[model samples]
Target: MPPHSLLELHDITREYSLGKSRVNALRGVDLSVSAGEFTVVTGPSGSGKTTLLNIIGCLDRATSGSYRLDGEEIGDRDFDALAEVRNRKVGFIFQSFNLIPVLDVAENIELPCRLREEGGRNQRALRARVEALADAVGLRPYLHHKPDELSGGQRQRVAIARALITEPRLVLADEPTANLDSATSQHILDLMLRLNREQGVTFLFSTHDPRVVAHAWRVLHIQDGKLLSGEYPGVSRRASGAS
Candidate 1:
């Protein structure tokens, strides 16, 4: 693992048994992510991109090899330990918004804080936080609206706010732009980039879109269940500028 890496995976491998056969999702994959970096992972379908993200986010354990978060070994931790780590240190954004249809925007954003029991944030504070996040994502006008009442883009903005509600050290987004149109996708990407710069929040995402990759400070390319490139250095200007 590199020095100052907040997340590290060393020779990690994950496999699932399908009847008599074994399907390897990841093989000897190594990666390190540092603080304040926006890293994008891209590959073809069935290339283990989502699997890798799940492992890194502590949502699933690896079959073999060492995985570390903030220098703490996570592969060997129990389920409860992993859940705690995820709740306190990691936030997740998915392509499908995943907002509760019955919950209003502010309620959805406050769900993480409620789960963590980090009280002392009275309704006023919570509302302020939600308002600030909504303003940032342009969702302030829909605070009382439920998920079913909002458009796909609005729901996604609510999801982003919910992900950041916990102020986690790391945010993992899987195909966040997949549900939006081109214009909305660009807007959301810009929001994420600005948040990364302003809040110094680390971000890792799995995406196939070149537009998404263009916003990243680093890019990892995976092939055949292995990390094929993006081991050293960060994003290149030429690559960033490429269409």
Candidate 2:
């Protein structure tokens, strides 16, 4: 892996076993994401986009080949080890907004720090961080509200804040805007783009939404468990005269 590469995958493959058959979710995927790159992997349903993101995010392991994150070889780590790495190095945002229904916005954003293997964080400092992230994601006003109390866009904002609170090296968002309306989706995408640009956050998204693809800094196309070689680096909505 290059010194500047935040993530590298070499010929990665993943397979699943059924009662009497097998499934190939990924095959020979070679990818390297440089630090702070806002890249999106796009494909139709069942195109392995989610599988690839899962492997990269450490939520799942590959059946073959190597995976390096921050120059560390972690593909073969056991479940417990992987969990540790995930809590320390990766953040995730999901389409469902995955916020705990009972927890208020502030508590949800602060959850990751509490779950860390090292549990001696200062309460004052953690609260400060959570509040800062909430402000950054436009959730400061909703800090005391539960997930059920916010609108769809505001809930997604909370999820984004939660993902960023850990300051993870990588953030994997799986179809994050799937439940949002078109206008709300654009707002969410703009928020992500701002975060990526201002905080140097590295984001990898798996989605079939053309609107999301339109905003990506780099787009990777996948089909049949293989990545195709077309990228629109630095091309986006602005280039197409769309506001």
Candidate 3:
């Protein structure tokens, strides 16, 4: 593992049993995502994008090989241990903007802080965090609104705020802009980029959008459970082009 790598997967393999047969989701895949890097993973459907994200987010375990997060080996941890790691170290932004319909923006944003038992984040501190994130994402005016009352873009911003509430080391965004329009997608992408740069928070996203690919500092192309190429900015235009 590289010294600066916050996440590392070494010859990782994950297989799912289907009756007497097995399906490989990831096969001997070696990947490393360094701290403060905005890395994007792109591939066609069934290309192991979500599977890889889940493994890195500690939401799932690989069937074989080694995995590490922040230099700690995680392949041997149980499900509960994985959950704990995810809660403490990883933040997630989903395509669907999984906000509770009944909760207001402030409540939703502060949810993660409350979950970790990180006391002393009183109502005032929580409000401060929510307001800062809302302002960052251009959702400050909607702080009192419910999820159903906001537009798709606004709700997604709320989700982004919630994801950052914990100040996690890594943010795992799985198709975060998939549901938004082109203009809205650009806005959301810009917000994520700003957060990654300003906060020095590492971001890893799984996306198929060429726009998303264009914004990434590094791109990983995966196909059929294999890593085909790793493209860094200005290195390989052909490889960077989305397939």
Q: Rank the candidates by lDDT, best first.
A: 2, 3, 1
Backbone Cα, N, C clashes tallied per candidate:
0, 0, 0
| Residue clash pairs of candidate 1 | none
Query: Hey, what RMSD does candidate 3 come out at?
Result: 3.8
The root-mean-square deviation over C-alpha atoms between each candidate and the true structure, in angstroms, is: 3.2, 3.0, 3.8
Name the top lDDT candidate: 2
Candidate 1 to truth, TM: 0.92
Give residue 223's error in model 2 in angstroms: 0.8
Off by over 4 Å in 1: 1-3, 119-121, 231-243
- Candidate 2 achieves a global lDDT of 0.88
Global fold similarity of model 2 (TM-score) = 0.93
Q: What is the lDDT of residue 92 in candidate 1?
A: 95
Model 2 pairs in collision: none
| Highest TM-score against the true fold, candidate | 2
Candidate 3 overall Cα lDDT vs. reference?
0.87
| lDDT by residue for model 2 (1-243), tens | 422899999999999998789999898999998887788898889999999988888889999999999989999998899988898899999999998998999989888888882236488888888889988888888899989999999999999998998899999999999999999999999999888877889999998788878777689999999988858756554255332
Every candidate's lDDT: 0.87, 0.88, 0.87
Pairs in steric clash, model 3: none
**Per-residue lDDT over 127-204 for candidate 1, one digit per residue giving the tens place of the 0 to 100 score:** 788889999889888899999998888888898899998888899999999989999888888888878877877899
